[model samples]
Target: MDVCLLYFEDCPNWKVTDRRLVAIAAEHPEVVVRRKRVETMEQAERVGFRGSPTVLVDGADLFASPDSAAGFSCRVYRTADGLEGAPTLEQLRVALGLTQEVTR
Candidate 1:
């Protein structure tokens, strides 16, 4: 599985997401994680960037919201606890279908 993290330079949450992705990588050896920087408006439009820190699983936004518009800005996630800059760890695991036991 290929997981891509899309974010802009100003986004603060991308690093957090990257850290989580690193953890996930350790757990899921078969998955490859990549980071894409959306710099310009045209690039964002071209890539369908919903916002910074958008998690794309095989080029599809995993936590996409119908109300959110595509742009180059910080994205807020409606997590289980509340509004957060990035999705929670559990949320990501669930989205990626990695809820099963992490191989030791």
Candidate 2:
């Protein structure tokens, strides 16, 4: 599975999402994780970034939402706790269908 973390500068949650992806990637080495930065509004539009720190699984947004007009903004994520800047690791695991068990 290919995963890409599309983000922009000044997005604080991007780092946390990056860390979570790193750990998740360890479990699925075959999954390639790429970081795409949206540097401008045009870039954001051309790339169809839902918001900063948009996680794309196999070229599709993990979170299913009606595509917005497309702009540079801070996107809020839906988490177990509530709306958040990023989803929990477990949420990501389920979304990606990755196992939490560590192979010995």
Candidate 3:
């Protein structure tokens, strides 16, 4: 699977997503992870960037909502706990189709 993490320089939440992706990659060797820095509104629009730390699996947004619009801003995720700066590790696992039996 090709996983691309789209982020900007200012958003700290991207790091959280990156770390979770790293952990997932460690367990799933087939997963290839990459990062893209969206620096401008034009770039964001051209790339369909919903927000910082957007995860794209196989070139599709993993958690995109119909209402999401491209912009250079922080992205909030709706996790089990509540609104969060980034998705939880469990969320990432589920999105990536990782089995629960696998642990870091």
For TM-score, the strongest prediction is 3
Candidate 3 backbone collisions, by pair: none
Give the TM-score comparing model 2 with the true structure, all chains together: 0.86
Give the TM-score (vs. native) of candidate 3. 0.91
Over 1-104, each residue of candidate 1 has an lDDT whose tens digit, in order, gives 99999999888999999999889989899879999999888888788799989999888887886776788778888765679999878888878888863322
lDDT of 1: 0.85
Whole-model alpha-carbon lDDT for candidate 2: 0.81
Separately for all candidates shown, the number of backbone clashes (residues 3 or more apart, or on different chains) is 0, 0, 0
TM-score of each: 0.90, 0.86, 0.91
What is the C-alpha local distance difference test score of each model?
0.85, 0.81, 0.89
- Model 2, position 81, has a per-residue lDDT of 74
In what order do the candidates fall by TM-score, top score first? 3, 1, 2
- Model 2 stretches astray by more than 4 angstroms: 99-104
lDDT (C-alpha) at residue 88 in model 3:
88
Please state every model's RMSD to the true fold in angstroms: 3.8, 4.2, 3.1
lDDT of candidate 3 at residue 94, scale 0 to 100: 79
Q: Is candidate 1 or candidate 3 better by TM-score?
A: 3
Candidate that scores best on lDDT: 3
